[model samples]
Target chain A: MSEFGSNSENGGRVLSFEREEKCHSAGCLELVVQGKATHYHGPRNVDSLLRAMGENSLYANVRINGDVLDRRDFENVSIKTDDTIDILYFMGGGACST
Target chain B: MFDLTDEEILRYSRHIILSEVGGTGQQKLKEARVLVVGAGGLGSPVLLYLAAAGVGRIGVIEDDVVDVTNLQRQVIHATADVDKPKVHSASETMKQINPLIEVDVYHERLTRDNIFPLLENYDIVVDGVDNFPTRYLINDACVMKKKFLVEGGILRFMGLIMSINGGETACYRCVFEEPPPPGTVPSCAEAGILGAVAGVVGTLQATEVLKIITGVGEPLFNRLLQFDAEGLRFHEVNARRNPKCPVCGENPTITELIEYAYTCETQAPGSS
Candidate 1:
């Protein structure tokens, strides 16, 4: 049911997004990449990693080492072995008026 | 310099008793002015705590009317106040908590033209807003104005809080860069936030604000504090100031406020 149903595993770890009902995708629930955890070395390209984790939807913002990965570069972007990747998103519902 | 009355001394005795926040620190609080940009969930706790801490002048802006649904987490409002403007309703509660402090209420929306003049009077600004556009707007404004800003947000069981000393520290834009395109991220209404999650983040924002006012402790500057209520754990992200950040970077690009046309709840293009 995931948009990216690739077979290769992702290289970086994931954060609170796995099984996070609000998260965009599934299949990467077991990987914990918050702060400094373990790193999977399968795919370096962000697109490939996201595809492998099934979180490849363009909607989710990919953050690598603190910078927001440009949407145009997701396909070819490379993640270094020491890089930290966080799949982040947000909600709009505080005072609601701002 | 404003002096704390005998009654205020008794009321904030616990705070004044602390070596870090003695009479001197309490006096600083009395002279500090803070602006809170929202009256909903996160704003609720920020308002309550700041008011209770005896912040001299507290200004709140919101063009929203309270709704029944808000009762779940917007603790500052009651069922009876559902039809009332959020600012008025929240201000009343704040006054009841402490009649000594002044609560300035603005029942208007914050716009690019008005943000500067509005923020000019306050020493610190707190972002308890819900939407991303407003979040980025507040950050950009504070960074440009060189005012301290305490930013917090909640979605589901996750919450993020960070403090920015205007251009000196890592701003919201420095960490998140730009608001994710609308429809890409879910809204609290759709994503479902735990009511207490807002409390957790809002209270933290209030703490950061007080810390800024009294200069007592280290604020969350250059650090993004992430909270997971479900797991009851906290995560800290190093929010370093980036030279390439469009807003606070060396050669800034976002010279003016930018408002996204759509809210977060907007459905992505054609997706069902």
Candidate 2:
């Protein structure tokens, strides 16, 4: 996920093409950009978007499509056809406080 | 009991004629309490229409004294009222408009300590306020108390309106997420607003309040309506409640109130 690749996860578009450019002090996430093809862009999409983002993780827990994935779920989640995903930024934990 | 005499009904004949707002609605107007924050550009119309619509107990909150420049857009105040306390002048005008209604004036700045208590007494809260800090504060208070909020804002030629039913509808935080860092946006005093633009937004806010009170018409919940007077166009975008929203999300983060100091030191350097 270093640069643009014809990964089936991104339809035909490029995925994870840049280097992390420090976003904040917290840290960054390695993203894999799933361009036009798969239209799947998430925290795990691009390495640079992730690197730039640092440790500022988007999702404390998430599920690709319908599969529930928590903090440990980011690496194994596979991209499929017509699956829309959002790399929502979650601070502290996934649960709401107020 | 605020009785409506035949003369009063006659005076409000048009409003009373609507099936949605007959005597019962009129009576609700008499009983309902609304607190309008800010007495400036947007506040002027909100106050004017809410008062005219016969909202029973209307409270106008403002600490700003009237200024000569405000007259161009703040219709509630007159040229002679310049330098007069806005709360005093606005309340005076409301009483003149409808002596039957109760007009409580708060000639004090809206601060965090007072926001919660002040909002608690009102049935509906109208955000005719300009700055983001007060707007966010108002939103938080309303959500926490489950009060209906009618919010309207105008910048230059554009404006936005949202009806927050607290937990029932998308709040102001649901859309923008955060305010534009400070000094990113200019105020009316600096950027300049077409007087009518504020009137339009304020009037729309007043209408939303009436509908919420009278339970009539489609309220602008879950939607952000924008009006661009210069382009003569109106646009509406659907706003969904962010499941992760800090204030109104499914998993809320902001359990208590947090105050963000909002003021602009730059004098229209970035006006408009």
Candidate 3:
């Protein structure tokens, strides 16, 4: 609704999930998960469970389980709305900085 | 009158066989002009393929010389060619690959002052440059000149190829926003790359060049093709033109070229 997708908010919890719940793009990810307070997700919030698993940025594909969740797939994806989101890591390295 | 002889027809028969590329594509390639910056790892295969693919006019801009270490991945230059100017060595090899193609060699580095005038003549620009400064410079120049740019980069075993059709597609800065500070990500010399990775990525770039000229299937405009050689997988990332990009934005901020020097104060391990 807010320029990303679907209807306006649709009024529900916006629980955000990334492998370790971190932000890889240096941008912020906000989740209204179940309409509680909007959970601010980024590199600064490193203690959360979603981020503890290193789910910040994925290479191959990321699947989310919930229908209400807003997922931004950076690369390739085959999202399943009915199940928990899965992250498939590819190119397990960084790009050249020179 | 770029007539295809019997041998020439046979050599390019596979290309002419495709409805997308046919005889018309062959002719386009013969008339196409390309400007290649940096004759290093990425440029090597790109130059080789573009030459062999029959791009009529190919220009190479490189200031560096061939070093012993560069031979590991810069395949165009031979061991005997080491210590020679890369533009000279690369031109020799490209001509050998296809004497029919014209090779314009720039013996000096591509700087802000020189890049504009140097690039104005070519139909397309291929960025095989290793540094961010040149990368950004080439992109901005292409956008300013309304030229197509085939950009590629390699780090370790992974690489990506994307073509910027200037006003038509998202520029490099649209996706990356800004380059990481120098040395934040290690160079191939520091990280070590799989030599063949250049061949893979550079070949893809050459394919893009051919596609652009031939008007073939799905050019990589507005999309980034990512390759992971170790995993043997390829993926395409959708890129959006940033309204905020300094070069091609609605209100561009970078009105001119700015030189940024990023070199280690201390000598690297294999520093000459």
Write out fnat for all predictions, comma-separated: 0.28, 0.00, 0.10
iRMS of each prediction in angstroms? Answer: 6.7, 13.8, 10.9
In candidate 3, position A67 carries an lDDT of 19
Q: Judged by lDDT against the true structure, how good is candidate 1?
A: 0.76
lDDT of 1 by residue, A49-96 (tens): 677665534535567877767766887887655567676545443222
Report residue A75 deviation for candidate 1 (angstroms). Answer: 2.8
In candidate 3, how many Å is residue B51 off?
A: 0.7
User: What C-alpha lDDT values do all the predictions have?
Assistant: 0.76, 0.66, 0.67
- Using lDDT, rank the candidates from best to worst: 1, 3, 2
Q: Give lDDT tens digits, candidate 3, residues B1-272.
A: 54777776787888889888888889899888999888888889999999888888999988788899889888899999989999899999998988888999888767889988987779899988776666777888888888999988876677878899977788877765555444555567666778899888888889999999998888899877667565465655566686777888899988887655646432211111
lDDT of 2 by residue, B8-48 (tens): 78877898899989888888887899999888888888888
Model 1 regions more than 4 Å off: A1-32, A39-42, A51-68, A80-82, A91-98, B263-272
- Runs off by more than 4 Å, candidate 2: A1-98, B1-3, B265-272
Weakest lDDT window of 10 consecutive positions for candidate 1 chain A: A4-13
Query: Comparing to the true complex, what docking class would candidate 2 get?
Result: incorrect
Error of 1 at A66 (Å): 5.0
